[model samples]
Target: MQLIESISKRHSPRSFDNKGIEQEKIELLIEAASWAPSAFNNQPWRFYVAEKNKNPEFYNNALNCLVDFNKSWAQTAPVLIITVVKTTYDHNNEANKFALHDLGLAIGNMMNQATVLNLFMHQMAGIKFDKFNKLLNLPQNMEPVSIIALGYLGKIEDLPAEIQKVENEKKRVRKPIEDILNYSPLK
Candidate 1:
């Protein structure tokens, strides 16, 4: 798919079908993430993935990390992924101020790649930090970022009433460039 088309198609779908994604497709998404640029060439992003059928324990663990609202709908997805980043540069052991930004870029790349692969991803920031760290036994230096639920889109009618309204009204909306862009100081 063209870049613009992929961007236009991308959406945070809350419901998913039961079908499993091919391992090769998942690998391509990760590969896209790996190609994202990082500050000082410190590729700090890390991804932990779990499939419901392949590993129930792991999938359930990932599901438990989400906030209650997300848990309700995101549970239907076939794959769950947790993204983290090393907090500091390895060689110097100094704080990497751009680590989170780099991780965000990686996720953006993955999202577009998923669109290109005819898949969908819904990313959430409402994660239980302590629970996630404990469940995964993450290193002290690694910081959890977000959880992503992936699969093919399911019926929007299955979503909660409020969410269904939003999806039905206008699935996508964004601030116009004129409204968001500014070069001069405000009066």
Candidate 2:
């Protein structure tokens, strides 16, 4: 699919099918994330993938970390992907300002790739940080940034009323290019 078309079609789908996603496909999605650009090539992102059926307890625990509204639909996604950023780059390196930005790029790549694969993805920030960190056994330096729920698409009817309302009115909304870009005259 073209980039523009994919961008338009891609959305945060809250409802997902129960059918399992192929392991290979999941790997491909991760591969897509791996190629995303990083600051000084630090490659600080790490993904923790949990297949729902295979690890129900872990999945439930992760889901429980989410806000009640997000939990309502997130539980149905076949896979839960926890995105983390490694705070340290090297033994002496203390600054990692771009870690989250790099992770965001990787996630954008993953979401776009999912759209091309006819899959659905939703990045969620509504989570209990402390609980998620402990449940996933993440080190102190590895901060969890977001949770991505992945699976095949499901009917909008499956979503809660509040979510369904948002989904129904969804359309690509963005700021004008001129508004986003500034071309200052030389001083």
Candidate 3:
């Protein structure tokens, strides 16, 4: 049994090359994300991009919003994006429970596009929420989700010695499908 090459090759690495991503590729990632299905077709996902080469100051500001641990390694990535979501439906002022899920779908699409472009992405939940919210001056109805670092693979040596092997050389593993799928009664 075979899987999509991009899906199988996709991986999250802490080490990223300093080379900048081309503008066209970045637009393609966003285009893919924009097409993800959303509840009521609201398309709540919003991206705050910081390209190291194009917007260094904003890139540094975005980097500062991440926790120290993430900041340490994420700095090497050429592109950083903070995904934001609208918490309420645009047609009505009611809450949208599926906002986050929709955001995840959008990010998934973006990551798949990245893989096709030979780029890798590492999505981190280690953000300073308060700082990030304030940094972007986000509205009450919008929420910051996760920070994503995107770039080409870098030397394992660029990562801290403690995690070098773990990040770049470790074997990939996943739980068996039987462990996750409910083939029979839950009991």
Candidate with the greatest TM-score versus the true structure: 3
User: Tens digit of lDDT per residue, candidate 3, span 1-187?
Assistant: 9999889999898889999999999999999999999999999999999999999999999999899888888998999998999999999979999999999999999989999999999999999888888877888999989899999999889888766756756777899998998968987
RMSD of each: 2.3, 2.4, 1.5
Q: After superposing candidate 3 on the true structure, give the runs of residues whose Cα lies further than 4 Å from its correct spot.
A: 168-171
Q: Measured by TM-score, how close is model 3 to the native structure?
A: 0.94
Pairs that collide, model 3: none
TM-score of each: 0.91, 0.89, 0.94
Q: How many backbone clashes does candidate 3 have?
A: 0
How far out, in Å, is residue 66 in model 1?
1.4
Q: TM-score of predicted model 2?
A: 0.89
Choose the strongest candidate by lDDT: 3
Worst 10 residues of 2 by lDDT: 1-10
